[model samples]
Target: MSELRFEDVTVRYGTGRRAMKAVDGVSLTVPTGQVVGLVGESGSGKSTLARAAVGLAPIAAGRVLLDGRDVRHRPARGSGRAVQMVFQDPYACLDPRMSVGDSVAEAIPRTGTAARRAEVTRLFGLVGLDAAHISSRPSELSGGQCQRVALARALAARPQIVVADEITSALDVSVQGTVLNLVRDLQQQTRLGMLFISHNLAVVRYVSDIIAVMYLGRIVECGPAHEVLTDPQHPYTRELLAAAPHRDGYAANSAHEESGAVLDTEPPDPHHLPAGCRFHPRCPVGPLALPARTDCLSLDPAVGAVGRRHATACHFAAPLPTPSHQAT
Candidate 1:
């Protein structure tokens, strides 16, 4: 099985004093046949990290490896590329003038015209689109259909790894579940290593095998999906879970009350990141709930293992008491 690994990857934009580390010292792996959900707030660099995997973002340091081989120097687009990305805006990715069939066909490796057309039909069906709509243009499809077409295009390349960046966030609430279910189904059937990026905790929980919680440009916590959601160790992870809409008592059962107030403030400027722990200023368990720890303000905490394969990057990382309202 193939594996996509981000080894201490750092993505920096601009140069000199203006440079911003959009993804900082992050290491994570997505082994084929499993989904690793990357979740965080809007500016938490989740998208940047996804872009880096497909070579859309420049890496200032570290490497993105596919099966232990560097992917930075490899082709990031076309059929030759092993990594494919499904962007958030599906319509934007498709050409308005091209027939949806032709759009998907563009990613397939060269073959006989009849064979290519057949492959396009098969891909459409794989993504749950009607083969009859193959000739339809992007303007003729609904938002959900367009997103599925985008997914079809990505899969047409026969990629080893797929990076889905908020692929369902653009669709209607009713449509979101359909697209998500299709994704989960496709992943299971194809066993493609997938990095699913979203800010929605509930959505991540629905499709992910493992979950990585990012904050600022760093991953603050990560573990099996169940463990991270049920017993978050980092302050940011707890706050993120609490902020999610209640689902199966998961959100409501988070250690929010003990973790402290909701995160109301915006994160610090990326260009002028705070010293020490980057989340110190807004961390509920730190300055917000108790006296600010000097370590939190002046020293960056290294990620430490809290459980089997579960890790958190906080000096005070510990399991909070189970919430009283937790579902049995």
Candidate 2:
């Protein structure tokens, strides 16, 4: 299967004085039968990058290539290029008055009522929903069911790649887990390439094969999910894992008991980015830093290989000690 690749892509919105680059020059690859988890704080351009894959976001520079073909030039949906997106809020995309089945059926590119119904039913089954849900309206279903419907709709198109943009962020914690499992199962069964974007690193970790960390429109780190999560090399990535709540009591759920010294500074505006290292101002490794780099403020860091399948865009990238290795 052909992989979906972002080759030094840059996405900008608006023009001139009001212009903002939502996604800076970035590259990512999502191969079939794998899920690439994208995690970062809100407005970090995770969704924008995913949108680019499906031709939803504008590409100011570079290209979103699927199997070596640009999405814009490829077949729209039924032709051959099948890239579908399940949005964050299903309510916004789903017609409230439409029945769940009909919502999904709308995406099925088939002719005649019989063909449509058959295809929709197949999609429903694929997404783990029973035929009973066909007549139920969106308002009558739980958030999890709504999300399933959205996925079913995307599946109806027979997409090779699926962009799930914060699809579970709206559900309850319990429901979120259930939805994530469904997604994982579906991906494995279909061997579909997936771009799973989320702010919750835990959720990403549970579903992704590889993880990419974004910050203010640029990728700061990308690597195997285990390495990026357990032994993040980039400072920003370390900050994210550090800030993530840990179970100090469950395994030991003392999550609330441990403190992570996270920087709380406001991010720079997209329209006016910092001149050098985008993260310089708030970097922990400043003048008081060990292995400090006096040129951090003047030198922009590019993504460099740190290990096998691991890359970080920081000059002083180093892995943080795991909880077991750190002083309690």
Candidate 3:
């Protein structure tokens, strides 16, 4: 088991004035045997952070560490790579011409031919795929099956950390649950440190022990799964929970009604981000609230503790009012 730590990690694209910061000074930890869910809307830099872990995205500052060693410039090689990623689109990741078993076999460290075949068979079972599909191509399998092959390929690498970037977003609604369950079961069995990225709060909550909310390339809130879900502190987080689909008996209608005005507009341009709080333009409790907090325009709030194992990056961080609170 190994832990993956991001120490003030920053990722940027392009150069000079045109450079856009995709992931800003973010510090997150994915301890062994636990899942850290990274949740945010599209373009919030959730995927960029995932890519950085596996050397797909370039890091401009800070370090990505595995077991206390910096892997920023030179990622671990072979089995030592430790971190493997499962991308959002399974079809895109797997080669169209290759057999599914061969695709998975490519990721395995060099071994005897018989051993490699046995390993592929074992991985197929591990991901709940039938051994019969070993010779199937990506086009021959359904969306859910393709994702299973993707998971199996990642497992073939024998990684200690798995970064799953919206793995289920591409599947049908009914199939998503099955894949999520497989992931949770696999994590328990292997105890692999995982960074699961998604835009859906409900999905993240179902699979994660810890959850971190991102906005405009910065982690705006982070805490234990239950605490963050039932009592979101940051306005952006609250808005996200409010907008989450009311399924699985979870509903944040009160928060939705209170903060619906915030998300009506799009987030500010990342290339030319606003000064101070990047979320100020769409923050309900900042620029849009009654009396309008002026400090949000000039002072960037750093992430700070709001509860045990809970932190939010907002000067006005507070629990979103519930129906009971409103009555009082």
Candidate 4:
């Protein structure tokens, strides 16, 4: 069963005509004992959806289901401890004044002094932090260490699902792999479900069993990580994979970053998203379509399955025999 699910969820910012939907009609599930990776560029609403699950973001429409219950009815004030989040900034989320031991101990249900201490010590070892560092403050620990502490605190509650929003984005490349390995091993041991969000495709592809691609608040493609990365159907997915680092593929994203997007226009205003396929305006081939690109410009495309465990939302989406220009 899906431990966490979003059913046509939409998160809006502002009110009246000024309101804009940051996450629109997003339906996803994080089942038990699996990692679902979400990949998108900045302004793509990846974080918004992640926040909605934990009652941090208001759901403008639709429902967020946590452990088979609607979050709105659950009243996150009490019965909402089933899900925990590890944010992008490891240091910011932590309390500077509180000692790391106390921070983790706070999550333990046991009120006895000795019980809390023992649990904290065990948690420290689980996250690879030393028992000696229990009294350390946030300022005393390194970035990676602080992150491990944050993770320890999250796990102390034994939440069923963990929402990790770019948790490693701020760490050094050397530390990033270590953190990833630690998380993967922990997930296996605990059978914890995860919603991993990041702009880094390499990390996502490695850790995620399934991957979903987002653009401008809409999911454009989703499937098994390896299939989606190596044989993309949607144009945007192809671009994202082509730019993925360490893959034996051409660096198309680098060119896009240096010069400009494939489409030679200003970034679309999120406040006033264009009608039709949200990705069409930026799609290189959509403009040249027959029928005056009416469907491409006016009708939103529904996600259609093209192969096993794969789907794409594009009027022109067609899987290539080999989408990536990788060295054979």
Count clashes in each candidate, considering only residues at least 3 apart in sequence or on different chains: 0, 8, 0, 0
Best by TM-score: 1
Q: Lowest-lDDT window of 10 residues in candidate 3?
A: 251-260
Among residues 3 or more apart in sequence or in different chains, the pairs in candidate 3 whose N, CA or C atoms overlap within 3 Å are none
TM per candidate comes to 0.92, 0.87, 0.91, 0.87
- Pairs in clash, predicted candidate 4: none
For model 1, the superposed segments whose C-alpha errors exceed 4 Å read 75-79, 252-256, 303-309, 319-328
Instruction: List residue ranges in candidate 2 displaced over 4 A.
Output: 74-81, 247-262, 287-292, 303-309, 318-328
TM-score, structure 1 vs. true: 0.92
Model 2 per-residue lDDT at 234: 65
lDDT string, candidate 2, 1-328, tens digits? 4588999899999989999999998899998678999999999999889888888888999988888888778564544347889999988889998898888777777568999898888888888888898999999888888899999988887788899999999988888878999999998888989999999887888889999999989888898887666666666776667666665211111222223232566777878888667876666554324335666666777734343235677766643334566677
lDDT by residue for model 4 over 190-254, one digit each (tens)?
78899999988878887898899998888888887776766666767766776677555523333
Query: Which pairs, if any, clash in model 1?
Result: none
The predicted structure with the larger TM-score, 1 or 3, is: 1
Q: What local lDDT does model 1 show for residue 155?
A: 93
Candidate 3 Cα outliers beyond 4 Å, as residue runs: 72-80, 248-260, 303-309, 318-328
Q: lDDT for each of the candidates?
A: 0.87, 0.80, 0.86, 0.81
Deviation from native of the Cα of residue 53 in model 4, angstroms: 0.7
Instruction: Give the least accurate 10-residue stretch of model 2, judged by summed lDDT.
Output: 249-258
